[model samples]
Target chain A: MSAVAKTLDVKGLNCPLPIVKTAQAIKELAAGDLLEILATDPGAVPDFNAWTKSTGNELVEQSEEAGVYRFVVKKKG
Target chain B: MDDSQGTLSLVLFSGTDDKLSSASILTAGAAALGRKVNLFLQYWALENFQKDRIAKDHGVSKDAEPEGASLMRLMREQGSTQHWADTFRQAKEIGDVHLYACALSMEMFGITKDDLDPLIDGVWGVASFMLEADGPVVFI
Candidate 1:
């Protein structure tokens, strides 16, 4: 299946920004697309889960490399 | 999900000051479900509703401490009042949460409107806040 990809740079943004921006980005994308979020804020873990659950989106991958935190979310139809 | 599930208004009355996770959880839950949410910030919590003061450094994980420190020595060791306005500010930025400062609480604390944070949508007395509370309200 072909999927679209989008990236949101949310570094320096605190707890809700990363989540809020991620939700907004997913809202603009089509289903089956990937939303990659880069955030330095450590609060993104639980925050993203809460966001995905609330919005019916799918969080496919989450990891931290060096000091940068990254998450991949799939948009809901 | 029912888009029109009426509305929920949360009235937070406490001296807990800036720890907003409790309030955030309620507001976020409502917002997530696309429900109308109103959060009234009273007492010291109103200090968190300001825009300029909010952006200031409030340290980290300070809000983790709940009301009435079970272990005083432990709390002091853990650093009481670390002040995390960032998290609170984040909750405000997320859409669908309505924040207000309690007028009675403000007067009790001798806080003028200028003393309050600008992010506060409006200031209201108990009567105004209570009207919404009757519909569907949760006290945090």
Candidate 2:
């Protein structure tokens, strides 16, 4: 597993906010850095997928446990 | 990264909290995906942008009467929902989002640019808004 440069906890935020904050947080990371996001919104699953694809970032890992959705995205090099 | 997803133009005609919140969410989502978002505030929507009224309660739309209105109020009281203005601010911070007041509406309300909250970029005529719309405009 690649090292995560940052972990964004957006557990309580609703739709758009989780993705919005992720977009803002990922901007501060260097290329190739990994951003692990923890979100409670079920929408995050599909939101992250579309976000990564549209923004050209790599969704290196994704999983859900006990209703919490986790995603590890690597900034495009 | 493809920041060229094109512009999403929105016409905000309703001033209700629920409507504004919905529009704000759409703006933020579009912005997060690297799309430019242009919001044209008109009629009641433009009136709500006044600096003194922006933070006040604008209430829910008529469609959300009775139980639905109370649910929204409860969420807001619980601090579970973000204010629409703040959402728009964050959207602008992270992407190409611009808010403009309709010039005709401004004249109707007798409000100058300074009367509005700083969140609004400027006052624009219908022609100017259409020129930048670039695609189908969504009215809220």
Candidate 3:
């Protein structure tokens, strides 16, 4: 995928907060823009996937290292 | 799944902070997923909805008291000052979420809107809520 157009830093935040912040951040981007999120909440893994599925956004990549989960999501066109 | 018109409903019976945290998390998720959410508060949940009681109502369920206290302490240690109230408020801001205090509970407790946090949408009964909610409802 192309380079991310925006990044959301939600480290140290918990469930619903990270997802909530992601939703708000995604709203600011235009269609097809990429969103990068950094989160630490253990629930964030499945939460992001579910949010993308239900919101019709695309979660292109995800990874975890040192307890931090990173995700790249593409907004629906 | 992006059907924005879909709905998720909650019947909140417990007033404990742990349950509230879980319920609010689910509410926020549904809202983020573009679904409307309806929260029906009764009994203890209704009583806890009072504006003055919200801040101080931070106990978990009695059965899990030991674990709950430690977990709460851990969350506090990790800088988790965000409460379920904040979650519910943000859910409303992000999507179409409505909160109702059961009239039956209200009558029993002699409660009014003036007693509740402003986040409550209105007072409603079970029948009307059932008819209007066209989605899954979970009791918390």
Candidate 4:
């Protein structure tokens, strides 16, 4: 069964803000929880990937729709 | 390959309000992730190494700014203005981070050891800081 998910819309935010806010939000979730992020910054992909790698978090799904970048991040550690 | 041995050294040259704040945030974030991080401050960034002068220059505790650029404003805009001194201090304590002052810059600025903050690990030339930067080194 899939785990519960939470969403955070950080549109218009730039580098470090998106990552830092995502980190703060993810920390509040339990293991296996999903974080759905909506960001408009072009730097989110690389930044989030690095954040997940370093933090042991899992990037479950990522895609863009209508100029808004969306990512589903699974909380690991 | 095992990823445990990699180290990231950053040579932060620009002391501009925007760049230095961002650099500090990046270093702190990497240190938080258990990475071996070294930050070599040169040129204007070296001003941040001084004790009484650092706070006065950066206006960290004073809630002031230098001329047109506000150090606090820039970092706050990026959501990285908080607990900077503490972040550096924590990184130093955990052994994941090393803060160094560039000897050449120090000499050019007529600054000596006594003028620098005690948190600084050591002063080194370009070659010394370059040795540990095998993985990735960013010049800001």
Candidate 5:
């Protein structure tokens, strides 16, 4: 039983947009709900890591395949 | 890891797009991480923001003069490049970030609140900004 409420595909959007969209999406979810983000930006790896740390969001699971990166983030207040 | 130092304070003085873009990247990166970000714009940086031309100018630094044209062309081709100011504004929606104008610079240049982008949170003297913002400050 996963807490994930939805998935957001922000592939092809680079840098700030990806993060920007993710931030926007997370807002609609309740605390403890999860969001799955799919992105193609190679920088997403480090960027996601840093974002999770700063925002107090929980990066529950993450994986990379080829150029695409997948992330599961739990909303935290 | 100085994660405890979770605030980013930037004193942006350059008017060029390259420098602004760098600041935006830092702001977004920091903001996304849940750190607070404060940007104090002054001199040329504040001068560049003409509301009508808010997102149109891409004046590059003298150092990047040689490659400026090609880089801009590439950016145009990518179509993914966004104005740094807009990036900063968007970052605010997700995290704790603020944009401020330098009071002395505003007076020196005859800039009014009306002249600045709406994204600017407020105007304050350098002393005031320095007092309120602390952790890590970057001067551009």
Candidate 6:
């Protein structure tokens, strides 16, 4: 697995904030770097998938545990 | 990411907090996906963007009723909900989001560019707004 370049904690935020914050965080990363995001919003599951897809990034991994959703997304090269 | 998704234009006529919040979320989401967002504020919506009043309470839409109002209040107290203006500011910071005040509404409300909050890019006429609105506009 590729190393995570940054970890973004977006817990307690709802709706578009997680996606918005993720987009902002990803912008600071070099192309091909991985961003690990931890979010409490249930909507993050689908939001992350769509966000990565539309932005041309890759969803490297995604999982949920005890209501928290985690996503590792690789920036498009 | 490329701005290949095109522009999403919003015509905001309502100044209610709930409606504005919803609009801000839509703007932020579109912005996150590399879309250019253009917001044209008119009528009551323009009034809420005044420099001195932007942070003040604009209340909920009448349809929200007392119950919906309390629910929103509860969410706000929990810090789960952010002010719509702040969200718009963040959207602008992170992406291509432009906010414009309707010139006709500005004339009706006796508001000038100086009276508006700094978040507004500028005052625009209806024709100017339509020119940038390449896609179907969402009215709120």
DockQ of each: 0.20, 0.82, 0.71, 0.12, 0.56, 0.84
Taking all chains together, each candidate's TM-score versus the true structure is 0.58, 0.97, 0.90, 0.57, 0.90, 0.97
Candidate 1 runs further than 4 Å off: A7-21, A27-33, A36-77, B17-19, B47-84
Clashing pairs in model 3?
A: none
Candidate 3, residues A1-77: lDDT per residue as tens digits? 59899999999888778999998888899999999999988899999988888889999999999999999999998
Off by over 4 Å in 2: B1-3
Angstrom error of the Cα, residue B13, model 4: value is: 3.2
Give the winner by TM-score: 5 or 6. 6
Model 6 lDDT tens row, B1-140: 46787899999999989999999999999888889999999999999999899988888999998787778778888988898998999899888999999999999999999999999999899999999988899999
RMSD of 6: 1.0
Tens digit per residue, CA lDDT, model 1, B1-140: 33456567887654343345446655654555456677787765665455545545332234545443444334434542223343344445545656778888877767777766655678888777777764867776
For model 1, fnat equals 0.13
Which rank order by lDDT, best down to worst? 6, 2, 3, 5, 4, 1
For residues A21-51, write the lDDT of model 6, one tens digit per residue.
9988998999999999999999989888888
lDDT of 1 at A74: 86
* Candidate 4 residue lDDT tens string, B1-140: 11374777888776554566567677656654557788898987787668875554353322233444564566557753454554466455534678889999999999898898877889988898888788768887
Candidate 1 local lDDT, A27-66, one digit each (tens): 6777888888999878778878766776677888889999
Worst 10-residue lDDT window for candidate 2 chain A reads: A10-19
Q: Please, what are the lDDT tens digits per residue for candidate 5 over residues B1-140?
A: 22465668899999888898888888887776667788899998888775765677667899888789579657857867677877888888878888899999999999899988788889988887788776657999
Give the interface RMSD of candidate 5. Answer: 2.9
CA displacement after TM-score superposition, residue B139 of candidate 5 (Å): 0.8
lDDT of 3 by residue, B5-118 (tens): 677879999999888888988898889989888899999988988999987746899987888877876786777547888899998888888999999999999998899999
Stronger candidate by lDDT (1 vs 4): 4
Q: A2 in model 6: Cα distance from truth in Å?
A: 2.2
Retained native contacts per candidate, as fractions? 0.13, 0.83, 0.83, 0.07, 0.67, 0.83
3 against 5, candidate with superior lDDT: 3
Pairs of colliding residues, candidate 6: none
TM-score of 6: 0.97
